[model samples]
Target chain A: MMVYVIKVGGNVIDNPVLLEQFLADFAKVQGKKILIHGGGKIATRIGDKLGITANYVDGRRITDAATIDVVTMVYGGLVNKQIVAKLQAVGCNAIGLTGADANSIPASKRPVKEIDYGFVGDVVAEELNISSVKLLLDAGLTPVFSPLTHDGKGQILNTNADTIASSLAIALSGSYAVRLIYCFEKKGVLRNAADDDSVINLINRDIYQTLLAEGVLTDGILPKLQNAFNAIESGVKEVLIGHADDVRKNTTDAVAGTLIC
Target chain B: MMVYVIKVGGNVIDNPVLLEQFLADFAKVQGKKILIHGGGKIATRIGDKLGITANYVDGRRITDAATIDVVTMVYGGLVNKQIVAKLQAVGCNAIGLTGADANSIPASKRPVKEIDYGFVGDVVAEELNISSVKLLLDAGLTPVFSPLTHDGKGQILNTNADTIASSLAIALSGSYAVRLIYCFEKKGVLRNAADDDSVINLINRDIYQTLLAEGVLTDGILPKLQNAFNAIESGVKEVLIGHADDVRKNTTDAVAGTLIC
Candidate 1:
């Protein structure tokens, strides 16, 4: 049996129509699956409304104390619960969770080097609780995780959703043939930045290195591709990055988006 | 063989020392247990900080859209996760949840009678998902619930923690001998509002109604006592209302707090 670890970003989550469409398609997936979500834009927007300005270093938000509170509310409370309820409405037995819930994932605070990223967490793959997650999956419950982890010292830390998805996929790969999916707004990793239809259908580690050396892949796509390749090397059976609406189509045809092997 | 349903209010949750002490004691409780928590004051404080003025009618905060967002962040995100983490540190495996998780509790939006309570939810006992909860409990996992429920229609509704504790106790009574405990700052139900030591040791239904008629049991204690008697009549084995610090003492002595029969 195949298990999928799907990660969706704010572009799909913030839009009600896109979210509903993605969840409906997600519910149709066969076998065991998990959904990990990101809500950075929503968190920042809510922070702005609350008069808390967001600070970013190298395109990653520096999570301050107040910003941590805001993200917990937006990502863990609002976005997470709303997605679970929507899935429930579509006959999916979704169980929403943060890392602190059942101590499913314990992360260490990121050590400061160049910038002080307050309250940000880095999860080690070994510390992930596979048994508890397997228990939920065995009971036919789909776990929906928010991008939050605990330090096991009563502190909730903001985490990266893609990192979480990849980590879960790598850790669970020992028991299940895991497939990691990254769903967003674009068709996939575009060969040309301007063309929505210019998706690279397949990429190996050599192609990824060549794309990086040629400066064809830069900015946000770099980290995503890095994560995909890392998951593949770490034993994930496959990795796919594509538009949220094309999940079913991509999986069915086995030819959509960028497939990393 | 026995299940304990403990409810703690904001008075304890808002205080760091008191909360740690209480969770330490709660972690020591033998056998299966669950916790329900309230966050009215914390929610109102966050709402005020966000420039959203809270509206109230007959002492219940009208859960308008903004208030609902605030409470969801404070209660479900901040407070719930914090408690679960604390419990984990004490070697107790706690899984935090809102009613929407696993569709554990489905409620209906409260209909406007004389007051429009905005997004408040009223849960019917029949709609409670006892099996999912039992799955967690039987696995030796403690469920820490925040006072939030969904309407099964994609709307998250603000609920009262006391009501949730009572409903859960009533629903689970058939499977285990359930003991419902309400923990707060005070020693117990006091004869006079000012005296902390003047706790009524026991109160039957007749005495409860007589005390209410005589205007002795008024204000916050009234609703709590009502919930206590409701639980008892609904088949819960025991109900206790008292100080959070005295939970272990109360259970051991079987003589602490006001016992409702």
Candidate 2:
């Protein structure tokens, strides 16, 4: 069996039109699948309304107590439930989830060094409750996860949506041939970085090394490519980086994204 | 097999001390159980912070668009997930839910009558999706539902927690002998309104009629008793009105509440 563990971020989440198209495409994808969504700028907007300031240091935003609560409401509650309802409307049997629910994804609070990322969680790939997830999948339920994990000590921790997608792919690889899809703003990993048509069709370890040696990969796409390779190394069958609009096409044999083997 | 469908309202949800103790006891209960929780004053508190005004008509609060979003965040996100994490800490595999999640409980928007309750949902007992719920319960997972439903058209609707509890009990009665429990501040139905210890341990239709004739039932108690009898008539094996502290006991053979048969 093939399972599609797809991730969509703020580019789609914050835009109603984009999200509708993305979810419609997502609902059309066949077979066992999972959706992990990121908390968009709506959290920051709500936090500002509630007087909770967003503190950022070294380019990474911190999840303080108040901020975590705001994100929990926005990501875990408002956005996640709304998406689930919308997916249900589109004929997808979507079940919304947080890591705390069914202990599906237990994580540890990030250990403080110089910066304390207050309520952020760092999930260990091996610790995911795959049995619970597999049961839901086997029963024909599509899980839509909000980017929230719990520390088992009764605390909801902020987590990266991308990390959740790749981690779940690696964990579920044993049960199914998993294709980890990362949906972003661009069409795919662009060879020219500016030209949308310059999407790299296929990249194996050899091609990736050549691209790196030629300085063709931009700093922004570098991390995503690295993550894709890591997921491939960890056991995921395939990794696809593509535009949210291209999700349905990317899922098929006629691919539309940068498929890293 | 006996299944406990328990409901706890604002009194239990608002107080951290009471909620913690109640969850601990709830976790100790054996066998299949489901929890339905009402949105507490925390919604109002957060609503006030977010500048969402609460509108009411002749005492019944209305759920406008903004207010619905706030309740969705507070009840579905913050409160529900928090309870899931706490239950996980106590060794309970709890999956938090809304009527929207998996479309487990489909509802219709309340009809516009004398006053329009903007986004409120009224669930038809038989329309409840018992199969999705039973899948979770049969797999050894407890469901914790927030008082939110959907109109099957991508809109989240505020619902009465009590109604949800009774509705689920009636819907699940075919597969399991359901014991519906409502946890409030009181230990049970009081023989004397002023005496906390004057608990009525059991009540049948005759006792209920006698109590109504004697004017022993208060305005609040009357509606609850009516709901209990309605549930009993609909197929629920037993309906227990008890204190949140007595949840574990109420689930046992030696019940600690007013058992309405």
Candidate 3:
């Protein structure tokens, strides 16, 4: 049986109505599945409430020690537990985890290159513990992960949700045919930024490069596509990027969103 | 093999040096074990920082909606993960959990009595999911639980740590001989409030009633002793209340604290 690793980000998670609708749809997916979530806006909002200023280099927020505490409270604690409880209410028996839980994902603190990202961690596929996760999955539990990982030395590092989903898909690909789904607001990767209806049905490596050269995919979408292609190259059976609501609607057809092959 | 359910409160947890020593000693215990922690002081501290006034009638803090959010962030999020990460550093493969995780413990919101305590849960042994916890324990994982539970209907309820430990012990008593230990700063139930060395070695049900009648045990110690006796009567193999440091020292003797019979 194939295992689905669904990645949901701030668009759905930050909005309660959308999150509930998305979770209801997510719960309907059959067989083994995992949910990886990101708390972007909530973390920032909480940080602001706590009088902590967010430091963003380029577009990505740099996680400092105090910011790590806020994210751990918001992402790993409040948001994660809230999702788990809601899933439980919907009959999905979900168990929430941080990287520290079961030492499932031991990442290293990002080295201070030109710009130090503070508490950010870069996860390697080989270092991700698939056995314990597999054990939980085999026992019929849906694992919901927060974008928090530990360095195995004691520090809980804030990580990227997309990276976490891709890493897990790649690591678990050996045992199960893994399908990684990146759920966001868009119906799929759109050809035009303004036109929601212009969903790109498929993007191969050649088309991806062509789009990149054409300046169609830049900024945040670039890294997302990069992670998707990385997962595909690493042996994940399929990767989909699409709307949160369309997850269950495309049960008969596997191509609901932008399919990366 | 016997399973130890050790409940630690904020006194030891709030102090960094004491918490480290306690966790190191806790990691050295033989057989299977679980840690249930309380965050009363920390919750209050955070709540105060957030400009929220803590409402307490008698002794227990009334968990209103805002207070619940603070406790969820502090107890279930920050304090719990910190303990899990620290335990990981000590060579203990600790998995942190809220009551909602794996639906391990389902509780109901406490019904309003003469005084209404909002968002607080009352745990029943039958509602506790021992099988899932046993599965995690048998797989060689030490579960560090936060004092938070869910109502199975999507609400996260703030629970008492001592109650959680007692409920877990009673529920798991069918399979494993459970020993419940409550660790705090005090040596034990002190005969004299001001004397550190005036430890009450043991207290049977009769002595407990007599002590209560004589006004020897009052205020905070009343509920603690009550929970201990409740656990003992519910078929827990043994229950001890003592200083955090003495946990590892009295391994052989098991008489380092106040034993409730």
What are the per-model numbers of colliding residue pairs?
0, 0, 0
Candidate 2 lDDT by residue in tens digits, A66-95: 999999899999999999999998999999
Name the candidate, 1 or 3, with the larger TM-score value: 3
Candidate 3 per-residue lDDT over residues A23-108, each given as its tens digit = 88888899899999998598787788778889999777899989999888888888999999999999998999988888898899
Model 3, B1-261: lDDT tens digits are 888989998888889899999999998988799999988477787678677889999877899998888888888888899889888988998999989999999999999988899999988568788888998899999999999999998889999898998899888888998888888888888888899899999999989888888888858788888888888888898888888888775443656888888
Docking tier of model 1: it is: medium
User: Which candidate number would show the highest TM-score if scored against the true structure?
Assistant: 2
Candidates 2 and 3 compared: the better one by TM-score is 2
Error of 2 at A178 (Å): 0.9
lDDT (C-alpha) at residue B247 in model 2: 96
TM-score of each: 0.96, 0.98, 0.97
TM-score of chain A for candidate 1?
0.96
- Order by DockQ, highest first: 2, 3, 1
- Per-prediction DockQ scores? 0.71, 0.91, 0.78
Model 1 lDDT per residue over B1-261, tens place = 879999999898888898999999999998899999988477777788778999989878899988887887788887888888899888889998989888898999999989999999998679899888999999889999999998888788999999999999999998999989999888899888888889989999888877888887858898898898889989999899999988887666565788888
lDDT of 2 by residue, B1-261 (tens): 999999998989999999999999999999999999988999999999888888889766899999999999999999999999999999899999999988899999999998999999999666788898999999999999999999888899999898899889999998999999999999999999999888999999999989889888888677678889989999999999999999999999999989999
What is the TM-score of candidate 1? Answer: 0.96
